[model samples]
Target: MRYFSPSKAVILLLLTVCCYCTSFSQTEKKHDVIVKLNGDQLNGDVLEISDSTIRFTYTGEKLIYNIKKSEILKITFASGRVETFNAPPATAQTTPVTATGASTAERRNKVAVLPFTFVKDGQNAAQEVSDEIQNELYALLSKHSGVYTVVSPRATNVLLTKAGITKANMLNYSMAEICQVLGVEFIVDGMVTQNRTTQTSYGNTSYSDKTKKNDNSDDKKSSGSASTSSTSVQNYETTMDMKIYNDKSEIVYNQNRKAFWNTADAYKNTMEYLVKRCPLYKK
Candidate 1:
């Protein structure tokens, strides 16, 4: 067995104490992260956690901050433990209860397509066209909606009718209210305008002339037959305005597109273009 003198034993004790302090200092360096409900993150030491508030200090600063637990979304501790705070209840304007009593939180990742509003020559056309566009849009979205549940047009229309939400009265309700009623996280609304741009007329004329007396004389009598035909084509210019809103009534996407072609059903192309580029669209 090795025996150390008093002075050497004291030195070894001091070294062990130094190593322990170093290890403790390294552990203390690890930060605790606080995530706020508004999406802000704070990195620092958590001094204390009270029932309603948390005491914290910035990583490099000594000034302590006391944050209400209600404002914090969660906290990640240095030891890899996570604590989450309850989210504040949404208000009526932000997350209204639906007819089925489902809250907006229950509508995550769901989408609803509303009946389009169609106008032709500055006058509101029949609702038949609006319903047609709605069905078409619903079909397109249902086919390509990645990670989103698209409510069928039939179901959406039924719900809207039950809520007394027609194209004329839709504007009276907030987007959040509409989304809640449809039980969807997002809603797609569109308006199509079609106006006659120009009328083009094309004609073709054909004439045949025969000189029977040309064999006898150069300036003999001549007979001619003529036929003419004309046709008129009407060209239209179409524009589509598309908007997407979340359950919070925030507009996530808004775009106005004009059809590149001048045809009667040009709005179809414009509508497809908007859908393909909207935020919910995925490869």
Candidate 2:
């Protein structure tokens, strides 16, 4: 009979323990599983639930993924928590704006839409955006009958110019000073911001090489090689903010909205959404 030494027994025990741990780690269960409406399953950890969206992270990956609630069928968590999503209604009810109007005394309030302040890197394009925002805001407000008497963009520009509000001196005045110069009890000021970014990624590559000998013989051969690749992704973001101030130079309403597209139509939609939600635009 062969006898094993104590040191040999200890070494064997350690090896067995290590092997067990490695096997357990390899077969560890997933933290959660997400079932998409399209019959796909994603195994990952559910990190957050907000904004009608779910943030999930795949096992062993640092990248986080976002899926809208509308796309998810259900989520099964490791701890036995299951969440289901119901399809959203096709048309949500639009509440009528019945109480957003000012009183009879307040209806006479005069409001001016000033040249928007541009927070950007370059001056040439910033000026254009500023002018566009000013024009759009004036147009929207002017169309709102009896909400507030809106000052025309042309007249507002003349008042600003006469007040020495050149590009050089525009940033030096306070909201009260601007209101005084525009001769209005309330004013609408805005800031426009745009951020654009791009990202590049590479996918798996495959290479193939082949060699053939000429039928005529000799020591000559020909070789051929081929390769394939994929494309990259690029994204952009833009944001705009609008604020309303009263005679006391206090903010009465403020809103900052952002969008992902960098096109003129996207900007227009953003402006529309923001303006529609303003306190003065109800009903």
Candidate 3:
């Protein structure tokens, strides 16, 4: 048997107690987290955080939510270490959990489509693409059985512009407004870009310092000037990024897709691709 001296035993006992105390203290320290919901921010202690949801206590209520990192306008940690988490899982939904067991069946059905933003950047004529995209979308949902029974472009445009979506969005709009625009159960909005170039020839000229300016101002004309023609085919380009929102104005889907006019069938090809990939297409 191994025996410890009196002093050694006392030291070991103290060390064990110290380690236990440190561990308990760490576990007891409340972990702070800030959550933003429906344009409201709440401060609370985090009881659990997982891939699908967060469990927190705030305002004297235990709340559970399905949220994306992007949905969180801001999150401040007690340790001051800021981190970005993943977006919500595709199947995970945002459902309001009521601690008081109250029913919420009277919410309005809202939706929106951000102005199909024109890809004005680079060499794209965003306005043209915007018009075309709007036309295509109009054509698509017009034929969908019940899709347009809720919202239309005319209505969406009026409502969206009122919500300050006159230009491209950098978080300038809200989900609730978007829901109102679409008129359906949700809303879809996105952006686009396109570019092309042409070849041309211009007369190049040179002049002598003394005689050219004084005598030949009218006589010099364009030395090699001749009637010439330039060719610039109408090339097209388009890119789109989209997001869907629920009545609460919470984001449901976010994705980006692109298209360009390289061949005669470019428009058809691009539209087909977008339709196949768009969530609205399936809806």
Q: Lowest-lDDT window of 10 residues in candidate 1?
A: 89-98
Which scores higher on TM-score, 1 or 2? Answer: 1
| Candidate 1 off by > 4 Å | 1-98, 205-226
lDDT of 3 by residue, 1-283 (tens): 9999999999999999999999999887555666453455656665666775656677456665455545664566778765545343443223221121212332233233445665443643556556567667566644542433435567656655554455545254455534433344666666555444443345545544433433735664333333544555454454556666666767666666556555323544555565556555544
Candidate that scores best on lDDT: 1
The digit string of per-residue lDDT tens for model 1 on 153-242 reads: 899889888787777666678888888788899999989999998999999999999877666667688799999999999999899999
- Alpha carbon lDDT at 160, candidate 3: 50
TM-score of each candidate structure, all chains considered together: 0.58, 0.46, 0.40
Query: Per-residue CA lDDT of candidate 2, range 1-283, in tens?
Result: 9999999999999999999999999898858999888788999899999978999999899899888988988899998999888653343322211222344345247788877766544333557777877898788767763656788888878877665675555556666666766767787877776645665656767767676767787656656666778776555466778898876688988989886565534566777788788766645
Off by over 4 Å in 2: 1-108, 119-126, 199-235, 260-265
Rank order (by TM-score, best first)? 1, 2, 3
Q: Which residue pairs in model 2 clash with each other?
A: 97-283
Better of 2 and 3 by TM-score: 2
Give the number of the best model, judged by TM-score: 1
Question: Which consecutive 10 residues in model 2 have the weakest lDDT in total?
Answer: 91-100
Which stretches of candidate 3 lie above 4 Å from their native place?
A: 1-111, 120-132, 145-150, 162-165, 168-170, 180-184, 197-237, 248-251, 263-268
